[model samples]
Target: MKIVYKTDTLPHVQQVSELFRSSGIKRPYDDLERLQRMLEHADVTITAWDGYQLVGLARAITDFSYCCYLSDLAVQKEYQQNGIGRNLIRHLRDLLGDEVSLLLISAPSAIDYYPKLDFERTEKAFIIPRQA
Candidate 1:
């Protein structure tokens, strides 16, 4: 499959929501307005497309200098395990450069996946859970 990566375009909300659902990512797929807002506010969005299909995405908010919060990384279930996710992260890193630190709160199922990608597991992070 010839996958093309793009940093300039934000995929439509419907495409993103569907990918989130199909990828088993726990996102507000039923809320299009929220999804749109999410995409609109993100500072960095990298998408992988196989022709016209969006196969993977990495969305983040960053200062382009010090820190980046990778809020979402999703790859369609059929496209998982193909290194798409890793490539997405790598692309994000290339954009952020060496001085920036990337941070993400992993979904329960993805806790183990991060370490294999050179991410350090740290107990130092804390969160106030969203009441949604």
Candidate 2:
């Protein structure tokens, strides 16, 4: 199966909600408005499509020059082992360039996955936690 990658377009909220749910990502998929705002505010977003179906997505909040908080990286469950997720990260890194650092908090299910993509595990990070 051939997957097309697009960075110039953003999918509709309904599409994203469906994608998030199908990808098994712990997002507020039932909240369309919040998801819409997330898309609106993210500095970078990359999506993978397979003949009109949304198969993967990556979203980040960044200053474009320094650190980038990679907020979301999801691939439809059926498509998970196909390298779509890694390509999404590669596309983001290509756009962000060498000077920018990409960092993200992995979902419990994905703790082992990120390092396979060259992401280093670090003990230097901390979070106050999201109450929602």
Q: What digit string (tens of lDDT, one per residue) describes model 1 on residues 1-132?
A: 988899998999999999999999999999999999999999999999999999999999999999999999999999999999999999999999999999999998999999978899999998999999
RMSD of each: 0.5, 0.6
Expressed as tens digits, the lDDT of each residue in 1-132 for candidate 2 is 999999998999999999999999999999999999999999999999999999999999999999999999999999989999999999999999999999999998899999999999999999999899
How does each model score on TM-score? 0.99, 0.98
Over 4 Å off in model 1, which ranges?
A: none
* Model 1 error, position 65 (Å): 0.9
Q: Judged by lDDT against the true structure, how good is candidate 2?
A: 0.96
How much does candidate 1 score in TM-score? 0.99
